[model samples]
Target chain A: MAAEVVASTVEIAAASQVGMKALGAGLAVGLTGIGAGVAEMGIGSAAVGATAENKDLFGLVLILTVIPETIVIFGLVVALVLWFV
Target chain B: MLAPEKMSRLLIVASKDQLAPITGALYRSRLFHIEDFVVEGREGYDGFSIGKPLAGASEASGGLIKVRSLENVFAIRPDDIDPAGARKRHDDLARVVDRELAKIGTEVEGLTSRRSKLEASIKEYEQRIHEITPFADIPVDLSLYRGYERFAVIAGFVTKNVAIREPAESRIVKGKSSNFIVAVVPNEDRADVESELAGAGFVASPIPAESGMPHALIDDYQAKITQAKAEIASIEMNLDAIRQKHADFLVACEEVLKSEVEQAEAPLRFATTDQTFVAEGWVPSSRIAGITDEIMKASGNRAYVAELPIGPHDVVPVEYNNPSFAKPSQFFMNIYARPKYTEIDPTLMLSIIFPIFFGLILGDIGYGLILLALCFALRKYFRGEDAEYFLKVIRNASISSIFFGVLNSEFLGFAMPWWPPYSFSRHLISEHGGHGPMIPELLLLAIWIGILHITLGRVLGMVNHYRQDHGEHRMKAVLANAGWLFVMWGVLVIIWSGIVMPLMPDLTGFPMLVAIPGLPMDIPGINVTMVLGGIMILAGVIFIARDSILEVVELPSIISHVLSYARLVAVGLSSVAIAMVVNFISIGMLIEPQLENFTLIGAVVILAGVVVFILGHALNTALGILGGGLHSIRLNYVEFFTKFYKGGGLKYNPFGLKRRFTED
Candidate 1:
């Protein structure tokens, strides 16, 4: 009975640590969306301005706007890593 | 020494009846003055002497005479001249002319001085008239039904008989209670009579005369005022023309004096173009290709050209395209070549960086959102390119800030796990000690970020050099950048494992030795690994120092070039330090509590604290961005550019349609 209690306690502690890490990862990625939105705000406006000046820059603007989105992708990767680990 | 010059002339004749048409054709050719002679009994014969040689005309017409001489005509079309050399000559001439004109300007002052005295007398008479008629009002009436043509108007009558003075034609009309008096006079003489009447204790006001006929009493006053104004304007116009001519003459005189007094110089070169002719002067060897191309394009191979190399270095080749409008070219050439043209085009680079840095420093999600909204709204409402550009930069910076804020793990001073999923001991809660994992991690991250940015700059420099065909230099830059990156990484790794102890021990002895002594030696946690880490750090420092010192001597080949990235670290550290300070200040505001009953006061205190936090952080963010962005640009200019950039290459400017605001 004493051994079983000790085992269960250790299992719960391990589960909690994993859960905490997963929570951290999720928060990182979820919060990164906010950051991504903020970044897009600048890029989208710049893209619009560039497009207005020269329609040929549409491709360039689209590419540049997506560059900031990489930050969020990184955050998402971190969350996936934590969950998988 | 002056060299011998050559001359070319052309002569042509047409029927006398066609003289006007032939002259117009010659004018179109931009050739100067044609002399005509009338032959006895030859009523239909006209002859033209075109004294000025055509720019590129090899063929001759039957009725035109063109002459090319060594003497330079002081015409206005300097744009036909080489831009650089012509600009220098123009400036030299302009300075001398300005000095001489300034001396003559004193004479203008004397003429204008008399105007002030006359104006003062006029004002005195006006004041006296105003005093007598203090309570008087001029009544004007317009009626169509007075049995007059179209409309009739009556104005300004006194109940008592005031001695009426008619300066021009006096006319009397019968009225109900008073006799109406009318006058007709020129506008100028009317003003003199008005002043005279004012002096005689009568109030006189001159209104706009009805059609061509004016009131007989006021007509004389209006005529005098008109004459005065017209006289002043004519005098002023003459004065202005004289000033301009004096200036031009003075310039020519000064050039002659400088040549005689200082050194024997070449004759002045002038170029002009008009509806008929395009005249250019002193085409340099470097600019010959461009000028020839322009002429060929404009005149289609029919230009008349003259070449006279009269001075040791003066090769004056003048071409006249359309001479009628060519004089303004000289004026254009005079104001060209300002330093602003060669300065770096800041538009593109500024657009990219400003907002990114601004946002990073601002770092608060809420505040960034607010700024983003404001900027966007302002840009939308104000339809200007500058406003739009500003908004774009702000939006980018805010985005960078949001990213930085995430790394900071802060949102309105609230912790990530607001309702703690699992609470650690409440006893462990201390303001300084309990900061979440973000701060230390961010500090480390900033250093790495600096390294990355510097690497990117070096890579760009390498690419730019390679594009310019400097392969060896590009290779050197790449190697130097790589060496620095390796060294920095190596040192960081050792410090991470041996001293900080947050990560597992990975790297060995050299770093430990240098880091131990360099770190707080008396700190309790100093260990053998720390000592080894210290040694490695010291070695890295020595490597960097050695390369820097050697760069002054043998140019460290490619190894020393990588040191330019140190600015990246410097700016990043500055940003981090500013961010920390902002956090501390904001947190400090929430420290003291108000009395228990004064709950409202407590809320007010919180609001004040929030305000201070926002303002203080916003200011710091602005300063940080400016510092970082400027330093980043400095690093590019001073370090990277010195390695590869050759910025002195001359710019290419093609002649095209230009507008001069000075004429209007």
Candidate 2:
């Protein structure tokens, strides 16, 4: 009887684990996106101001603004692995 | 493919009479880069002084100023007049310019003064009318109020009529809207009465210094003000008519006068010796025949053109000769600095590499197509020289990205049904582990790319150093580069044998068993690869600088530079990952749910998902375009150019006119 009870409890634990994985995936994408937004705020404004003065800097400023996007991308990869894989 | 055009200096000698036509010819050819004649350097030459402007320059300049004033007054633009008509008018203008200007000047001054006089009188009468209108109800002559010797009249508009003490008679005169009070108080009681009037907000009005009734004077002032206004309007109408009549002629006159001044002053840049003039300039080798022919024809064979040898001290200006396909890359190179005339132009190399780097970073078919569409749409609206070049680079990057994206089998981060077995990304993911995250494999690929890129840089550096000279120093530089290459290959092999072999023992045999004898491969922590790499690095340090041991520090920098390419894989992986997440939320969560349930709530969810889908992809595509484009150029500018390029050469700017208003 004790062995049967243990086996049933393992199945429930597995179900909860799957639910936790989904939560973790959501947090990874959401929180990292916020972080990317915060980092981009300063860079994006500075880039715009620079590009306004000299249009030649448009390409350069764009690179600077999207540089922080790598962080969110990392979060996205993690989320995909958790949910999709 | 890689070299700039060759340049040769020229010395042109011509008689003083021929200097004007010769300089004009040079300007017309648009092939000369003139070197200014300094007065201090004329000591060796006989009686050489700086050339003065031609005799006609002063007159032309004076006419230019007048023409500019007329243009401003008439608001005339060159584009508004027909070119042929303007040319004819300009040719005939010299005879009539002075006369027409004097007549127009006098007429404008007369009109201006008349208008000002009318405006001044109108303002004066309007003020008088306002003052008299308040007291129009008094029904008495203005002289009566001012000549009252015993009675003190306090009259102005008031909020209300106030109560006054006895012996002071108060009368309320109706104003335009408010009531005006006339209080005749004795001199002694005036102070007390004025205080009571102040309480009612009374502003005392000064009687007009005239002899007519208040209402009659007000009507007379109003009539005169109206007449003055009508006259001013008529004067303005006449001015406008004059402006319209002269607008086309004024613009034509300005263009003609400006060109005349430019031509007349051309002799100032030449060296003169009372009888003959001398000028020095550089012209491209190919254009020498054309320039010489033009100058000879223009000067009637009076001017001599001879090519002088380039000197060691002379700093020659550089102009690239890249093909049209590689011309756009010159924009990024120009931002750094023009390459020296003697050095290889890196534009062709950059054009090939930059797009490849961008394509590798943004390897998504959907995103690439979106970027390509964006470029096509944006290129139409943008104008100017720089804008066109910027758009061209973006278009090239988009094309390259699309090509690589197809190889990756990624459409908005979702794997396509048809995957090519030969694609690098597909093969990588499949060989490593087709499930879960493939970050480690991506990092490995990025490092391998970094190794290849940096090695190519070192090889270019080797060629550049060897090209400078063939001597002891050249050999030293060549050996130093070779040693660096050896060290790079050695370190990579060490990492493979030492770290990779232990992790994946089945792929390769143990390094100790396969080690070749006489090499330093037997150390415990270090294998044959590590020992060989160390020996090469030490040898490189010695070759680069035999005396200074500090050169060894640079060995680590080479490693770091290679590792920097890891960002390529990191960026591409992140982009793909984000695209997958977008697809999951929009399609999997929203669309799939609606397809399954077909409920009202499901439809609303799908609507929200569509918004998320559009907005999210747009943002990603924009960031990808920006990041991929810039980073690709940056790698060339920062990583690749540092290996071989040394910029700071002056650009070749030929002395010529880029005229838009008039043709030569």
**lDDT tens per residue, model 1, A5-84:** 99999999999998899889879778987898899999899889988997656544555565455455446545544654
Q: What interface root-mean-square deviation (Å) does model 1 yield? A: 14.5
Best-matching candidate per TM-score: 2
TM-score for each model: 0.34, 0.68
Each model's lDDT comes to 0.41, 0.74
lDDT of 2 at B189: 93
Spell out the clash pairs found in candidate 2.
Answer: none
Can you list each candidate's DockQ? 0.02, 0.14
TM-score of chain B of each: 0.36, 0.71
Q: Which stretches of candidate 2 lie over 4 Å from their true place?
A: A1-85, B41-47, B58-260, B420-422, B426-438, B462-487, B501-525, B546-554, B598-604, B659-662
Q: How good is the docking of model 2, as DockQ?
A: 0.14
Instruction: In angstroms, give how far residue A60 of model 1 lies from its true place.
Output: 30
Report each candidate's C-alpha RMSD, comma-separated, in the order given: 22.8, 8.2
